[model samples]
Target chain A: MKPAIDVVRLARHPKRPTSRDFIEYLVRDFVELHGDRRFADDPAIIGGIGFFDSIPVTILGHQKGRNVKENIRRHFGMAHPEGYRKALRLMKQAERFGRPVITLIDTPGAYPGIGAEERGQAEAIATNLYEMSGLRVPIVALVTGEGGSGGALGIGVADRVYMLANAIYSVISPEGCASILWKDAGKAPAAAEALRLRAVDLKELGVIDGIVAEPGEGAHEHPGETMSHVRKAIAAALQELLVLDAETLVQRRYDKFRRLGAFTLDDGFSELI
Target chain B: MLTRLFVQCPQCQTTHFISFFKSADYVCSRCGHHSRLDPPRWIKQLCNRGTFRSLFANLKSLDPLGFPQYREKLDVAERTASGWEAVVTGTAEIGDMPVALAVMDPGFIMASMGSVVGEKIARLLEYAADRGLPVVMVICSGGARMQEGILSLMQMAKTAAAVRRLHGKRQPLITVLTDPTTGGVTASFAMLGDVSIAETGALIGFAGPRVIQQTIGQKLPPGFQTAEFLLEKGMLDIVVPRKNLRATLVTILKIHRTRPYPVRRRGDE
Candidate 1:
């Protein structure tokens, strides 16, 4: 076995692209929006109105840097409260204008600094969860990579949630999970198997709606081709969701989350075996 | 010739018989420390007599990862279990106001947030939102369950998402943080309440102080994560004594009932 692209291996894989890389691929002539208005602009999340095949859509996602300096600037794709606030502001704007929303998720999590907490990091994530559930617009979340914890979920609730073939989405990181469970971070690979965080596995668990195929090994190997695959998936999902009325869309979204996870825990667990 | 069982206060170096602590309702007699209360007794203490009706009692956790020691540990919890499976979710009356309540019990697996705990809390919140009832949650956790791996971790987001609906409606969500509220639970819904209440002497922070100390290699200041410090820094609204928690909750509920929606009672306003 070539050691399948589960979330754990995906975390270690050399070729995974960040959200910004994917945004460059998918968004065309995108006008960027900034600031939660109440707070200063956060660099970790990039949002604005963008055109996809002449169609206007509000595009938002976590952005990370390729180099050390950039990572420091981007916080390794982790968002602060302002980042979430900005996205919410834009999302509200999108709802008003009757535009579809396409959010790309790629973050280890929300920023956990003392300052971030003091400024209401958890509240921001919580607000998104509450507000996004009722947004009167079509929402499609694309987990490009590293769908970490509450940060990813900050922008993750949607009518349809899709994951890139190599992307992973879970409540916690594999390393964190490993350390807590095994008392050793070295057993992360083993923890990854237990997490069932890969797209296909999550799809089996019914956590994600579908998986967008990546090009050649993974998305980083062939970025352009990968974008094409993502572009097609987003187009199809949005087309379907856009037709539904606002009330129907919101109700469907709530019911979708409510029905998530197998009843009795074992029903969800039995699938893993 | 009576047999006496003594419990030691973890904070203070004082020891007392089980009866002494029980009569004191699990508070340390010497230092006024509130020992972690079990789920059933605490639930009874908070809710009106026979008014607490538990729901989602059948939802137990699954060992998805099949971690060697987890299932057996769960079985041990089950064998001597109270009415809840880590958390008690139900509708109860506090001072005669009907509210949907969920209390995390440290007695069961340290009141950890797992898939079931998250699900129960989320469902309860959504239920409260749908019915326009208030939500009262008592949070006491060691964070996420490690045995369930990522499934355990996802509870943070899942539960937070549920709390969002209630918060969005501006419904009263009274959260009482008991001893040692840390990790993902504290980082998510535990702190999202309209009024964040912490018991005195409770250790509340995102990361444990030891981790922070070791990571930064600094001798940290004392009382960094205690309720008094957090309250002084505006992280918590109130730090009520355990004896006053029930009365305080009742009064808060009364205020919630009488206050107008979208609470515009700022001093300047």
Candidate 2:
């Protein structure tokens, strides 16, 4: 297995294939949708209706710019309240049309800013989690890059969740965790290891269904090969999920998430009760 | 001993006798700053006398990832908070209206949600849904516990999904947003309440103020992320004073007790 810090570096590689690149590669005639309807459209998240091979799908992801100017435009892939709301809007539409919904996760978490909070960031993300639970459509999600805390989970909560081989999914960024734990952000490498955020680790922990293998070096080194793996993984997941009825799909999705977490019951507590 | 006798209000810097503050239900007598309360005090404030029966009190957090110092922190939290986890969940009676209640104690590592907290809360909701009881949650957290890592993040979805399930049963979830609700807690079940009420002067938002300041590199406007600000922004349904919270909740519970009017579906009409 790769060291956690190296995986983090590869995940944040500037040349890595972003959500837009994956969409372009996997989706044909992708009609990009815009705006949350309740607020201004956030550039950080991009979504649309498109065809994944022969099947029509609703696809969305956190978009990081390939360059500095683009990064500024995309807010470094950090979504605001409107971005989540827009994703939710498209998802509800997908459910109504009986289309499978796909989300690519890549964010350093939600934007922490005055406008974002004032516009109800928490409510926006919360609404997505609630609505997605009963979306009544096959849904698959891939963490192609940084799955940072709730921002990533905002669009995540799928029947099947996958992660790129080199991707990192964590409750908090290593730097943030380090600063809080040790009061020094320089301990991020150690924090990264401790977080067990590597794709393989997450898969073992049952946070993700599987890992989409990356190409030699990383996704940036071979985008075509990486996208192929992602496409295959998503296809398999959708195939499995599509067979279930809406009620079963939703219930199974609920059960899947319900099984996550680690705890122990005190000896005094009776489980049979 | 001196510190025990005289307590300073974090918001107003008003120093007063501990007994005096306790008598006021931890609200500052002069400036009206509501001090954080543990589960026991919160239960006393909200539930009828001798009516709160604690449930899921035996779930304990394990060091799932074996992260450094996590066990030590949990040990300290158990000792300091006098509870197994950050939240104390149970069935309680408010205004003689039986309801399921979950009170998050900020004293327990800032009420961070980890495996145990998530499990307790999800189980509480499931219990309430099974019995068709309303849920009243007192939410006060700094967000997902970092030590548990990705599993902590997963709790956000787990709890939110549980809330969705409860709503599916037509059971109401009334959340009381207390001081310092932020992060995953804000972005999950806390904000999913059918009626979201905040305590006056509570600090409520998705991101912490310090984080916003660090990101924007400027001083935040006064009263940013406060209950009043959320109310102005239309994110919250109401903001009630700390003393009046129980009465307001009782009223809301009573109103919810009425059977909801049947609505026509798209094809039914």
Candidate of highest TM-score = 2
> Candidate 1, residues A124-199: lDDT per residue as tens digits?
7767876787789999999888888778888987999999888887766777777877899888777776777788
State the iRMSD of every prediction, in order shown. 3.6, 1.8
Cα RMSD of all models vs. native, in order, equals 4.0, 2.1
lDDT of 2 at B40: 92
Enumerate residue pairs that collide in model 1.
Answer: A171-B154
Error of 1 at A168 (Å): 1.5
List runs of model 1 lying over 4 Å from the truth: A1-15, A263-273, B1-4, B64-68, B126-132, B153-158, B164-171, B207-221, B258-269
Candidate 2 DockQ vs. native: 0.74
**Number of the predicted model whose lDDT against the real structure is largest:** 2
Clashes (N, CA, C under 3 Å) per candidate: 1, 0
Taking all chains together, each candidate's TM-score versus the true structure is 0.89, 0.97
Residue-wise C-alpha lDDT for candidate 1, range B120-227, written one tens digit per residue:
998899889888889998888887776665566556656766876785566788999999887768867887888999898998876666655644476767777778
State the DockQ, from 0 to 1, for candidate 1. Answer: 0.37
Candidate 2 displacement at residue B102 in angstroms: 0.4
